[model samples]
Target chain A: MELYLTKNFGKPNAIAMAGYLKHGGYRALRKVLKKMEPKDVVEEVKDSGLRGRGGAGFPTGLKWSFMPQETDGPKYIACNADESEPGTFKDREFLEKEPQMMIEGLIISAYAMGVNTCYIYIRGEYATQTKILQQALAEAYEKKFLGRNILGSGFDCDIYVHRGAGAYICGEETGLMESIEGKKGQPRKKPPFPANFGLWGRPTTVNNVETFAQVPHIINKGASWFRGIGTEKSTGNTIFGVSGHVNKPGAYELPLGYGLKDLIYKDAGGIRNGRELKAVIPGGSSVKVLPADRIDVPLDHDSLTNAGSSLGTGAVIVMDDTTCMVRVGVVLAHFYRHESCGQCTNCREGSAWLHQLMVGIENGQGKIEDLDLLMDVADSLEGSSICALADAAAWPVQGLVTHFRDEFEEHIKTGKCTSPDSFRI
Target chain B: MLSENAKKEIEREMAKYPEKRAVILAALHLVQKEEGWISQDAMEEVASLLDLTPIEVREVTSFYTMFNMRPVGNHHLQVCTNLSCALMNGRGVVEYIQRKLGIEVGETTGDERFTLSTVECLGSCGTAPMMQIGDDYHENLSEPKIDSILETLK
Candidate 1:
C-alpha cells in the first residue's frame, strides 16, 4: 500500500538530483525548515509511533529528544549506513536506488536534533554504494541543500560519508562513533548513551537509513497519517528484505503488522520452484527462527517478539525444504563468531564456543547432551557481554535447536545430514 | 612509502574529518587500492602522515578482513559464504571458482591473476550465490555463468 521508501527505487535516473526532486523530494525538509519548529518535528515523529528500523526498534523521535537541547559544544548525527547484519540487504538497496531520499531524511533529522555535522558511517564492503552516496552528497552540497544556508533558511550543515573497515560491530551506535574516532569498531558500555556523551564526548543521535527516510514523510504527511499504517505501537511501514528460497527475493515495504506468511507467499512470490517452506529467519541472523508450522504469526516488532523472535532489520530469510536447519545454525553462528570484537570476554569466547558446537553437530560428531549444552551456552551468553553482539550470536543457535530439535538430534544420532551440505571448507 | 597521489588523497580525506586519525580507514582504502595490500611500510607511512603509531595502523588493518596484510593476486575473488549466500549455492560458486582457477580458498593462482577468499556477508543477499571481484559483484552464479565471468576477468 502507499510506498514511502521503495517507490522511487525503480525509476530511471532516481540517483540524479533532478529525478529525485521531480518525484517531490526535499519537500519535507523544506516544509520542516519553513513551517515547523525542531521540537514540533520531534513531537510529530513521537506521535507517529515510528520506531527505529535498525533491529533495536527504539522510538525515533524519543531518540532525537535524548540529545541535550542547548549544548554549548558541537553535537553529532551518525547515520548507521553500516548495514552489516547477515541476511539483511534492504538498506543497501534503498541507498543504492534512492540516495537522495536517505539524505533528505537525514537532513530533516539533523534539523530536528540541531546537529550541524553528520556522518554516514557506511560498511567498507559497499565500495560502489559509497561512491553513489558521495556523488549524491556532492550534488546536494552544490544545490545548497547541504552547505551553509539551505534554501536560504539561515541554518548551516555539512554531512560527511565515512567508510567502515568491514566491521559489523560498527553497526552499533557506540562502535560506530569509535570507528569515526579512528579506532577499531568496538561497542562502548552504556549509562551515558550516545545522547548524553557521544562523538568526541558531545551530544549525539544515531538512526538507521530507513528510519530517517521515513522522517520526510512524517513531516510532509502528518503524524496521524503515518500512524494509520502498520499495527498499534509499531506504526509505519518497514522494508522487509526477503532473500533465499523466495521466488521474488527483494525489498518489500509492507505495513509493520503485516502477516509473515503473506510476505513470503504474496509479496516475495512464494517459495522458489514450488518447494515447501522448511523454516524462516523472520528478521536478520540475530533474531530467533520460526519454523514452517509457525508462519501464521504477524511479522512485526511486538508480534515477532511475542512469538519468541524479533523483526531485526526486517530481514526475512526464507528457506524451503532444500535448506538444512542445522547448517543454517552453523552458518549464522560462524558469522557472529567471526564478527565478535575482542573487547567482551563472553562475546569473544562464547561466539567461538557456539561455532565449534555447531560444527560438531553439523559434522555428525555431536552428542545428545550437546543439545542441552547448546541452550545452556546460549543462556550464559544472553546477558554476559558489554553489548548485544553476544546475544545476537547466541540467539540463532538457540533458535535452531528449539524449533528443529529433531533435525539437530537426527544429525547427532544418524551421523549424517538431512540435506546436502556445501560448507566443508 | 605512499605515492604522492595516495598521500594527496589521504590529505583530502583527513581534511573531511575533525582529526587526522579519523581518516585512517579512508587512507587504508587508498593504500590498499594502490598496493593491493596494506604493507608494513604503507601502514607505517600512513601512521606517520596521520600522526598515529604504526602498531595502531597494524591493529586497525589486522582487525578488518578487507585489508590484506600480505600481498594478493591482481584480481581478488571474495565469495560471500554467509547464510543467505551459502543457502543459495554461494559455497558452490566458490567451489566452482576454485576448481576453475586451479586454486583453493585463500589462494592465489600461479599467474597472480585471481585470489579466492570466502569472506563474511557482503550485504548482497538479495542477489545471493554471489562473489565480488574488485568493486564489481558477480551474482546469481552458476557453473556456466562462472565460466563466462572468469572469461571476462582474465
Candidate 2:
C-alpha cells in the first residue's frame, strides 16, 4: 500500500542525482550488485508477481528468466519509453520527473540480466522528457553508478538514449528493437523472440519504463512485501492515469484491483461539470470500453478481462454523457489507421476500412446493415495479424459498438447524432 | 548537406551501437533538427555516413512521421485531437488555432512563422486539449492560453 514508484513525484530536482540519492535512490542497485547474485535477483522479481506495465501484463521475472544465463556475446536491455498509447502518460512521469528512479531500476535490470549495454528507446514527441532523461543518465555515469566498475563491484554497464522518430508501432518490443537498429519500426514475426535473437542479433530483453522502475523497489523491499499490497494475482501499486471528462484528472498511484467506479468518482474527483458518466475505457484506447453500469468491476488485469476488457497500461479514459460514441469510434479508428505499420494486410487495410465505416456512420450516411459489417471487420482484424496491433485496432470499435449499439442504431435510423454535446469531427 | 556539428553528433551516436545502421534515426534527427527538414540530397548524405543506400535512408525517413519530408514553418503547432483531448474539446482547439493562425490544419502561415497540424496523441492526456509547439507542450489549452503562447512565439 505504500507508494514507491511516484513517491518523489513533485519534489524539486527529483530528476537529479542529488535529489534521488537524498531519498535512497541507488541503494537498491548497490544492494543488487553487492549482495544478490543474478539468479537471486531474477528469482526475487519472479516471487513479486510484477507484471509488465506496458499493457501486455507479462510477468517481469518470467521475462528475465528467458535470457540465456551465459551468452557468447553482449546482451542488451531496452527500456520502452515509447509511451504512445492513447490515454496513457504514466511512463512519461517517470521519464520527465522521477527519471533517476527509472534509471536506477534500469541499471539493476541490466545487472540481473547480465547486460552491459542498454538503450532507452523513447518516442521523439517527448523532447522535454528526452532532455531530462539524458541529464539523469549523465549524473549516474558521473557518480560511478552507470559505467564501468560500479560501486567497486567490478560490474560494467553503459546506458544510452535512442530517440524514436514518431512511430507508435515502435513501442512494440520487436518494433522497438528494430527501431533501435535504425530500421523501419515494424514488428517482426516472432518465433525467435528477443530472448534468442534480438537487437543486432544479440540476446535482448525489452521492459516498459514502468516495469524496470519497479525492479529497484522489489529488490529493496523484498517480494513478499510487494505481494501483500494488491490482489493475490495482481500485486503491487500501479499509476492509474485517469484522464478525460473528470474533475481532477491525473495519475493516481494505487494498488491493483482498485475499484473502477472509485477511480472515476473518488480518485479523479468524479465526472467533470456534474455530467453523467457514460462510458469508461479502463485501459488504453486499445482495450474494450465498459458502459458506466459495468464499471463496478475491479481494476485489475483478470477482473477486467472477466468483464470483457483488458487492463492495458492502466490508462482510464472516462467519458461523460455529452460525448458521442460514434465520434469516439471515429477518432480511435483514425489513430489505429494512422498508426498501423502497413505490414499486415488485415491491420493496414482493415483499420482504414473501420475508420471509413465509422466516419460514414458519424456523418449520417451509414446503413443499419453497416453495423453488422463493422462487427465482421472487427472480428477479422482481431487475431489475423502478425502482432496484437490488429487486435488493438479492433477492440475499441468492438467495445463501442457492443456497449453503445443503441446509439449507433439511433444514428443510422435518424441520420443524426443523439448526443447533444458531441463535438465536431 | 549536414552541418559539421550535426555530423559530429551523428558520429558519436554511431559509436554507441554495434552496427552503423542503428544510428540512422539519430542521424536523420540531427539533419532535420538543423535544416528544418530532410531533403533527398540530405538523405543521400546520411546514407553515405552510415554506409547505407540513399533509398535505405529514404525508406527509414519515409516510414516515420516525425521526419519532415518537406520544409515547415518556423514554429510547428501540433494539436492533439485524440480521445481524451477530444472529450475536452480538442477538435475545438484545432479549429481555434486554425482561425487564429489563418491557416488550415496542414498549411503554414504566409510569413513562414507558424504551421498548424492536427496530430494524434502526444501523451499529455491528463491536461487534455493540448498542443506541442516544438519540444514543449502547451497543456490545458484555451483561447486565452493559445493567444499568450502565440504572443511569446513571436
Candidate 3:
C-alpha cells in the first residue's frame, strides 16, 4: 500500500512550499475553509477514528470537540514536536522532510477548534529541522495562508515555533505547555485539563505533529478512507521508528495493524545478519519488553495493549540474541533516573533507586533479594506521579524483571553479569 | 553580554508568545548561540530583559541538558550512549573518543578544542553509534572514522 504519511518523502523539493502546493498541499485547508463548517469538520474526524499519534492514542476529533465554542478569550493549539521518547525519532523525519503537512494540518485544526494562535513545541536538539520548519512557516505566511483573513475566509491564525530545551518529561502535553510558558518542564496535575485551562490559562488543544499532519489527509481523503487504511480501532497509517540490532534500522510508515514480526524481520531487515531475535521493546523504551516467543502481536494500540505493552510513539527497538537484556535494563534505568523532573517523590526517588540497583547488579554487589526489591520499587512508582512519567520510568524495570527475572536472579547469585559482552565492539 | 544580533533575535521570539515570560527558553537559545555556553552574565541579562529574576532564568537554565552550565570546548563531542547506540558500540565510540582526546567522558582536551561527553540519545538511533558535534550529527562511527573526524576538526 502507498504510505499516507510519507507519500511525498522522496519527491524533489518535498519540504519546499512550492513543491508542497504543486502536489496539493494546503488544498484540504482551503476545502475545509471554503466548504465545511467547523462542527462538520470535527464530525468527519470523529467518524474517521483518528487517534493522537503521540503516545496516549486519544481520539483527535473528540479532543477538538472539547474546546469551548462560546468562550470569550483566546484559544490555542500546541503541536507536540517534542519527540524525545527513547527509540522515537519519527517526528523529526516528518518535520524536516514534509513541513507543509504539519502546517496545513494545524491550520485546518486551528480553524476547526477556533484557535487563532498555535505553537509547535519542537525538541531542543532539532536545530536543523527547526530551520526547515521556519522556512516553511515563512513561506506559509507570504502566500497569505497565515496572517489576517487567511485566503479571504475572515479567519486569522498564526503559527509560532517554540524550541524546548533538552528535557524528556516536556514531551508530556502539560509539561510541554509549562515549558513554553517559560518554566521548568514539569507536568501539571490533570482535572482542569488543557482543553479547559491551558497555555496561559486558555482553552487549548495539543496534538502531536503526526496527529495534526493526518488532519489534512482526513479532510482531503475523507474519514471513511482514512478509517479503511489502518486497523479498525487504530485508524490510518503511522510512522514507526525501528532501531537497535536491525540491519535496515530506520523510520518506516506502515499501516497501524502491521504485525510486529513483519516490522522487525521484513521491514527493518531482520536483526543484522540473520541473528536470532531475543526480545523487543514494542513501542519506545517506556513500553514493556516482549520476549521472542510473543512477536506475533499486531503493531496497533489495542493489540499491543492486550499483549501487556503499548504502541507508544510507534518506536520499535529490536534486540538480537547478542544484545544483553540486563544492559538494556541498565540503560533505560539511567534514562528515567536522569529525566525524572524531581516534582513527584515516587518518580524522583524511585528512578534514582532503580538506577542504583541496576548499577549494583551490574557491578556484582547485588543481593539475590534485590530482584524482588527492584520489582517492589517499580510497583511503588507506578501511578504515583503528577504525570505518566512515573509509570514510564517504572515500565522497563517491571517488563524486564517480570519477563527476565532469571537473568536478574543469576546476576545476584553469581555476583557478576552473566550476559555475554555482546556490544563490546 | 548578549550581542546586538542576539538581542534582536530574542526580541523577535518574545513578540511571538502571549506572555513575554514564555520566551525564556528562546532567550536562552539566543544566548547560547552567541556566547557558546550560557554565562552567568547572560542569564542575568536575559532575566532582566524578559522581566524575570536571574534565579528564574537559572532554574530553567539548570533544568535542560542543552543549556550548558559551564563553558564548553569549541568543539563539543556529545555522543549517544543510550540503549540503541550502546547496542551498536556507542560505548566503544566513547572509549575511542576518550583515547583519541585523552579526556574522559565529561572532560575537555587541554587545547580546549574538543570536549567529549556521553549523552542519553540524540534520536538518531536508526543510524546507531551517532554523536552530535556542535549541532552536526556524525553517525555510524568507527575508530578510524573518529580519528578522521577529529583530524578534520582542527
Candidate 4:
C-alpha cells in the first residue's frame, strides 16, 4: 500500500485528521515537547536525511542546524506555499486536500527548529488556497495544535498566513522573507542565509509546504524505516505533479526511485492519445529536459542529475511528438522575462533578450545565429546573479537548444514549426 | 474615491493584521477589484485607512503587475503567453484578440469594453492557450474560439 502523508486526500476532513492521528499525527511534536530538546529534534531530522521539498532540495535537518542554537532571539519557520513554479502544483494539491496534515507538519518543524512563530507565505493568486489554509490554521489553533503551550508541554508557537502579491519570485526563500517583511518580493544574497539572518533579521528556516508536511511521517516512522522506502541518497516518496501530454496528468505520490518510464507509461497511463513521448521536463521547468529514450532513468535526485537534469520540485512535465521545441523554448522564455523581478542586470536584460530571440525564432523571423545567441545569453545569465531566478530563466533555453538543436534549425530553415496541427505555433 | 462599502471592506482587511500597513496591498487589491483600477483619491483613501501616507499606498500599487494604475475596459483579459501556453499557440490567440479588438496588448478597446494584456503564467498549463477574465479561465483557445469569446463579451 502507498504510505501517503498527503496522498489520502479524498477522505473527509475530520476523518482524515482522525486517520492521521491514528497513524501518529501530533505524536512527533508531543514527543519533542515532552522529552526531546530542540537540538535533539533537529538532530533526528538531520539523521533522518529529510531534504527540502522545494526546488533547491537542501537537507532540512542541516538547515535547522544552521540556526544559532544558543541564541535567545526569535526564530521563525516560514512555509513556502507560493507554489508558482511552472508544472508544479503538488503543494496546492497537498494544502487543499489534507490541510490539517500540513498544519501538524508545520508544528513539528517549528518545534524541531525551536521556532515559536511561523508564517505561511501563500501566493496571492491562490485566493482559494489561502482561504483553505487560513481555515485549516484556525481549526488547528482551536484544536490546540497551534498557539500557547501546546498539549501542556509549555512549547508555544503561533502560525500566521501571509498572502503574496502574485509574484513568482516570492516563491524564492529570500523573496518570501522579503514579502513577509512587507517589501517588494526580490531575493537577497546568500551568506546571510535565513539560518543566520531571516524574517525581520532573525534566525529563520524557510521550508516548502511538502517538506513540512512530510515531517509528521518521518517523526512517526523511525528514520531508518523512512530511509528504507526510497533510494539511499534521496529518501521518502515525492508528490509528482505530472502535466502536459500525458494520459493521466495529475499529482502522483510515489517512491523516490520510481522509474520515469513506469510513471510515464504505467502510472500516468502513457502519453495522451497514444502520442509518442518527445521530451520530459523532470522537475518543473528549471531542470534540463530529458529525451524520451532516457525515460529509463530513475526519478531520484542523483539519477536525474546524472542524466543531465535535477529532480526539481518533483514536477514531471511530459511533451509529446506533436509539440514544437522552439515554441516551448519561446513560452518558457516569456515566463522568465515577465517574472524576472528586474533586480539584477543579467536577469532583467538577459530574460528579455532571450524571450525576444525565442519569439523571433518561433515566428519564423530568425537568422541561424539567434539559436547560438540564445545559448550565449543563457550562459551569461547562469550563476551570474544573487538569486537563482536568472539561472531558472536560463535552464529551459539551454535544454531546448542542447537536446533539440535540430528542431530549432528546422524552424529556422523551413521558416515554420514542423510539429503536427495540434502543436502549430 | 472609495465607496462606504469599499472603505468598510478595506477596514475589515486591516483588522486582520496587527500592523495596518501590512494589509495596504490587500486593500488596494479590493479597490482595484471593485473599481478595475486604483485612482489617486482611492490611493489616498487607502493610505488614510491603513494609516500610511498616500505615497506609500501609491508605491505599493505601482510595484505589482496585478494592480492597475489606470482605468481599463469592463473585461480585463490577461493572456498567458509563457512557456506551456506558448507551446500550444498562445501568441496566435493574443494576436487574434488584438486584431479582432483593434487594440494592442495593454490597450483598451476604442469603446472601453475590453482590454488585452499578456501575463507570465496562470498556473493552468493542463489546459494550455488559456486566458483569464475576472476570475474565470477560457481555455484551449483557437482563432475561432477567440472570435466567439469577443462576440459574447460584446
Best by DockQ: 2
| DockQ category of candidate 3 | medium
After TM-score superposition, the amount by which residue A17's alpha carbon in candidate 4 deviates from its true location, in angstroms, is: 5.4
Per-residue lDDT tens digits of candidate 3, residues B1-154? Answer: 9888888888888789878899899888888888889889999999999998999999999999999989889999999988889888888898877887889878888889998878877788898889998778898888888889889899
Assess each model's interface with DockQ, reporting 2 decimals per model: 0.72, 0.88, 0.73, 0.37
Per-model TM-score, in order, reads 0.98, 0.99, 0.98, 0.90
- The C-alpha stretches of model 2 lying farther than 4 A from their native spots are none
Error of 3 at A126 (Å): 0.4
> B101-125 in candidate 1: lDDT tens per residue?
8999989999999899999888888
Give me the displacement of residue A56 in model 3, in angstroms: 1.0
Tens digit of lDDT per residue, candidate 2, span A189-259?
Answer: 98889999999888999999999888889998999999998898899999999999899999999999999
Candidate 3 residue spans exceeding 4 A from truth: none
Which candidate number has the best TM-score? 2
Model 3 C-alpha lDDT per residue in residues A264-354, reported as the tens digit of each score: 8888889887789889998898999999999999999999999999999899988888776678888999999999999999999999999
User: Clashing residue pairs in candidate 3, if any?
Assistant: none
Model 3, residue B145: distance off in Å is: 2.5
Question: How far off is residue A194 in model 3, in Å?
Answer: 0.3
Each prediction's fraction of true contacts recovered:
0.75, 0.89, 0.74, 0.28
Chain B TM-score against the true chain B, each candidate = 0.96, 0.98, 0.97, 0.93
Descending-lDDT candidate ranking: 2, 3, 1, 4
lDDT score, candidate 3, position B110: 89
Per-residue lDDT of model 4, residues A186-263, tens digit only: 899898788988877889889999988888787777688778878898988888877778877778888888898988
